[model samples]
Target: MVTVKMLKPYYVKTEEKYIRIILAYQYFSIIMNKKVYQFIPVKSTEVRINRKTKKIENIDDVFAFQKGKEVLTISMSQLVSIPGFLEMLHRIAESYYLPEDTEAVSDQQRALDQLISELEYENVRRLIDKAIDNGDKEAFLELTNTLNDK
Candidate 1:
């Protein structure tokens, strides 16, 4: 009488060691007896994934959160019973580990580096103009020296 409706990470945080995925309404949903139910975490609902292996390392249940003090917890047992919960989590792990994302990040960083270089050059040019207009020989010589060193 139960069927999985949907399962996906609502929010994902990537770290140096692992990736943490949060499950909540719309993030993890199921249907039981024709009634849809969404999981809400009491204190912790983070699913920790191993970055290297792309496998789920931990799914923290309510009991694991701060000694299980809070109420309004999702049933971890029921979550496991969802038709494709584990499989979907694995798929998300794989998607997040794609090499293309790394390439895109590097490209963005290169763009930023170019922008910074252009701004520095513009600033130096303005300073050189100011030195010449003010007849400041010392500053003009220093500016030329600095540009040459670069």
Candidate 2:
């Protein structure tokens, strides 16, 4: 086992800490008495976009935590080699998405409305549009307000 010390002076002001474990190999040794354990440590980088002062944060200033604590790990390799790998992982996480979301649901509802009779559908059409306009679902309140206005 190897021990690494802090590269810079800092204070541990809080009692919270994070932990992550990764297994490098799964095969068991048949001839030897022990199994190999490889450990890795990850360095966190922060990201912030500012519009007022427009001051961007240094990547090193960001940190990742899990379960309400800052994460730390033991690695089998040098600490200097870990940042680049962590940055790549961050980039990949930033690019993922679910293409069909809530916007698509509203669009589908609009298309289905076309199949109903225009004369009979006018009240429903008005109610749905009023709901969207007021950002509220109380169709009866909107109808009452509309009737009172005239």
Candidate 3:
């Protein structure tokens, strides 16, 4: 079994196209034969997170978590498979989407409005994905229309 041992982001880099999140230390570990092993990187690692989907856009970036010793390089698929990996990335990614650096109350309200809209959009989209996964065609069509109206 594989689980995230550590998921604290050391830094988050945001760009117009994508968001890059850097997490270090014992980010993930696996249990084999009743023995636990931590993710150890041989080199620096990075992943590009999609803003809308809140998922890893590609696995081309090198990544293996490191702590002290126990350096074991893992595959991109392995990293992606961790249960909370995407959710963790999404939590960090949302901050970038929300407006920042606002000074006035009116501006703040506008930012909050934008944040609410974005959150609603994301929630609808996520539901749509779940519906597709569950093969609920009715829900899919309704969600598509809702998104279209938005």
- The model with the greatest lDDT is 3
lDDT of 1 by residue, 26-137 (tens): 5665665566666555555777877767766654455121112432344455555567776777777775663546788999999999999889888888899999999999
Off by over 4 Å in 3: 26-41, 65-69, 98-150
97-120: candidate 3 lDDT, tens digit per residue: 635434677888999999999999
Between candidates 1 and 2, the lDDT winner: 1
At residue 39, give the lDDT of candidate 2. Answer: 22
**Angstrom error at residue 15, model 1:** 1.1
Worst 10 residues of 2 by lDDT: 23-32
**Residue-wise lDDT of candidate 2 within 1-150, one digit each (tens)?**
222221211211111121111111121001112322222123432223222222222333323222225233432233324444334323333323223456888888777676554544566567767777887757757665764554
In model 1, the Cα lDDT at residue 131 comes to 100
RMSD versus native structure for model 3: 17.9
- The better candidate by TM-score, 1 or 2, is 1
In model 3, residue pairs whose N, Cα or C atoms come closer than 3 Å (at least 3 residues apart or on different chains), thus clashing, are none
